[model samples]
Target: MTAMSTVPWLTILGLIPLVGALFVAFVPGSAETAKRMALGFSLVTLVIGIIAATQFDVSSSAQFQLGEQHSWIPQFGVSYALGVDGIALVLILMALVLTPICLLAAWHDVPEEVGPRGGQRAKTYFALLLVLETFMVGVFAATDVFLFYVFFEAMLIPVYFLIGRFGGARRQYAAMKFLLFSLAGGLVMLVAVIALYLQGPGGTDGFLIERLTGLSIDPTTERLLFVGFFLAFAVKAPMVPFHTWLPDAATESTPATATLLVGVLDKVGTFGMIRFCLQLFPEASQWATPVVVVLAVISVIYGALLAIGQTDMMRLISYTSVSHFGFIVLGIFAFTSVGQGGSTLYMVNHGFSTAALFLFAAMLVRRHNSNSKRIGDYGGWQRVTPALAGIFLVAGLSGLALPGLSSFVSEFLVLVGSFSTQPVATVIATSGIILAALYILLMFNRVMTGPKPEELVAEGVTVDEGWRKSSGGTTVRDLTTRDKLVAAPLIAAFVVLGFLPNIALNFINPAVDKTLSYVQQAIPSLNPAGTAAEGSSK
Candidate 1:
């Protein structure tokens, strides 16, 4: 075993964003000032996140690096701790990269009325955003279970304010609903955590995750406890029946906020499953595999069907995320190392792909000057706005898991890994691929083809007091330089990661394999594949 140092730099990195948020809130003059401060802070965090990523020892398998541990609440055996292996580290970095992009997008994306409201509100919003970032990073890095739980619960505050204050017509309703649901989940999880703590190796002590994983519990208790945790995660993952809040929340919130909500925040749920359900309650996860796999399969098909019927672009993307999450959950419960690793990678890939699509859609909505994102609203857009169409096409293709796109590799790995333990579910889930193609292609055809609408072709059309014109005096305008700058990194990442996934896989596989080994050790009979990988070298 490598003797890793216990230094919680990652937690410190998370805190930097909160500090930035405070700075923005207290020293703001105008909305633009507040926005700039937020952006600058996010960028600083990004730089720190990059430094942390660079320090990561990629060759290590499952052992956390740059780990820091110290006592926080000695009475309850809770401690301040943080670290990450490959999967968590990658996700954290992805969140860091996207946060700045979202801030930039929000510079003009948020409605003026819902914006800063001058000094105080603008400061508060930025403060909330910064706080949200801190919690998100903390959740990924925390090595202590109690610390993870605290961060997990703490994350909802900023998101609540973000959606409630700056969302669409139904901002208040949607924000409240988002808060209530997540809080309910968190409360349930809190009880489960407390129960686990009380029954830990030494009663009323040790909430360190690694230490607790060594404690023994019977199958029944384990399964029950797993459900407590799983219910919380399922709601957060917004899996199927528990997903009602997602469509409305995404539809009503500003695009930039939705990007964080969907891209990074939702990931916390899936991340928890990997950390808690599989690692700490391995036997229970094995026992509950069938139920989880079935639900995951249903979410896949159901989310796609619902997405096809949606008129709101934001809502449609939200449903697509529900579907994508299904695939991730399926991979997790399949119990193969490949499946687990693929699930982890898919989580990262989906974050990027969805962020690109949502941001582009925001641009479209801005250009059109209408709340309606109906496919029929525009036509022959490719001829008028080639850049917009091109970016949309790239994003759509990525969503459908097109060959050489990043999603394709992760989706393929997930399906392959899932095939062994869940052949029936895997086969059914594979149909989601076809459905994905149909919906994505249909969206493209509706938006990019056919005759250009007469109204859209009119130049200098008055929109909310501003004169707006489509490109070439006969069609919609092409993507501006700013749009190109925003989208270039996203598209390039999709291509680079798509072709050479080894960059991510090198970091992910070891941790995934380690997790699988832990699960199998706890439930030897469930090793259906009979592979002798328990002792295999990474």
Candidate 2:
């Protein structure tokens, strides 16, 4: 076996942001200085993440690479251990990439040193983003179950403040709801974590996932623990009934915050389903699949339906995420290698697509006369801000899993993977595609391409009279250079991943196979499509 990299690359990747957060918070500087510092740190973190990715050997059978283990609390059997499979690595990299984009996109989100208190708030905002990056990286990288839980719950601190302080009018209400839901979920998972730990072999290495894996957990006990973990993930995934907090949170928070929250943090839910729920309690996972699949299907359809009913663009985008998450969770529990791999890939694709959507939508909203978020507030924007409209359409198309975009391949794999053992549920879930088209196209048509509203348009506007003058007599602007910089990489990712998904899938598929083998989900009756891959164990 190739010895694990000794430099603790994962820890460094996480702590670099931690150091950056502290620096940004304590140092006296203008908001511009803070923003630039934050961007530089996030970019460095991305570079490190990419370096770590290069070290990952795709053909190796190692379950985790670039491992780091250190005993932190010997008496209690808790230690600080970090590692990543292909799945966690991709997620960590995704978060890293999004962090810098969010920073740039939010350059003026908090406004630059406007009031006496503005500079301070701005510094705190960017610092909090850095802090959130640390937690996000840690949450995905931690191999110790206790460490994972710590990072898991710790993420709330930065996110809570980001929403409560920097968000819109109902920021406090949204932040509180989000906290309450996450706390409720975390509390349940804590009990399960404790229970699962106690059930494992007690030693100095006690809380490591390695120790917990394949433990002889009793069937009833296992099911209870699975419920605890799955419930937490479901809430995080914000599936159906528990999803009420998301729209408020998304709508109230800054667009960059919304992008990270929905795009990256929320992914922890589905990520947990794979990393903990299935691997730790295989029998329970199989046992719960039937019902979970039903709930996932409901989330898929219900979320899309709710999105269609939304007039608020941010709220609409938020609902679409709930719907997208449904597809992710559906792919996870579907039990086929392709389904699970697709689910992981979907997480990454969705992050970039949603980031572009939220950021672009925010740009458009900020430019509106009243800065209104209402879909009814604008029309024929394509005739004025064609560049912004163009990227927005790309984002919206990706959301609907349009044929030429990135989401199509992942969504297709999910459906194909689920169809064998879950034909009925898969067919029912497919209806979400039509609903998606309805929401995305309708949203585009209403907000982007149709006849202009009087308030949103200059008095003498016509279709060909593009670049219409606003009420202030200034011609409406398209995308600025900064906007294009943000748009280019995201659009490139979509195009590249769409036609050449193997870029990610090469590693993701092997990880999926390992997970399936470990969970023994390759049993012929349950997942015939993956039976051929049964022997490909980690």
lDDT of 2 by residue, 1-538 (tens): 1236867899899889889988888788777787888899999999988988998988888788888888999888888988888899889988998899899888878855566566888889999999999999999988889999999999999999999999999999999999999999999999999999899998987999878888887899999999999999988987988899999999999999999999999999999999999889988998999889888999999999999999999999999998888888888888888788889999999999999889999988877766789998788888767778889999999989999899999899889877877889899999999999999999999988876544443333332212344555535557666677778889998999999988888878877877777787323355454456522531
Question: Model 2 misses residue 298 by how many Å?
Answer: 0.1
lDDT to native, each model: 0.81, 0.87
Query: What is the total number of backbone clashes in candidate 1?
Result: 7
Query: Per-candidate TM vs. native?
Result: 0.93, 0.95
How well is each residue in 407-512 modelled by candidate 1, as lDDT tens digits? 9999998998889888999999999999898878888788778876555653323343222645644333456555676798789879988999878888888777
- Indicate the worst ten consecutive residues by lDDT in candidate 1: 458-467
Best by TM-score: 2
TM-score of 1: 0.93
165 Cα displacement, candidate 1 (Å): 0.6
lDDT of 1 at 295: 91
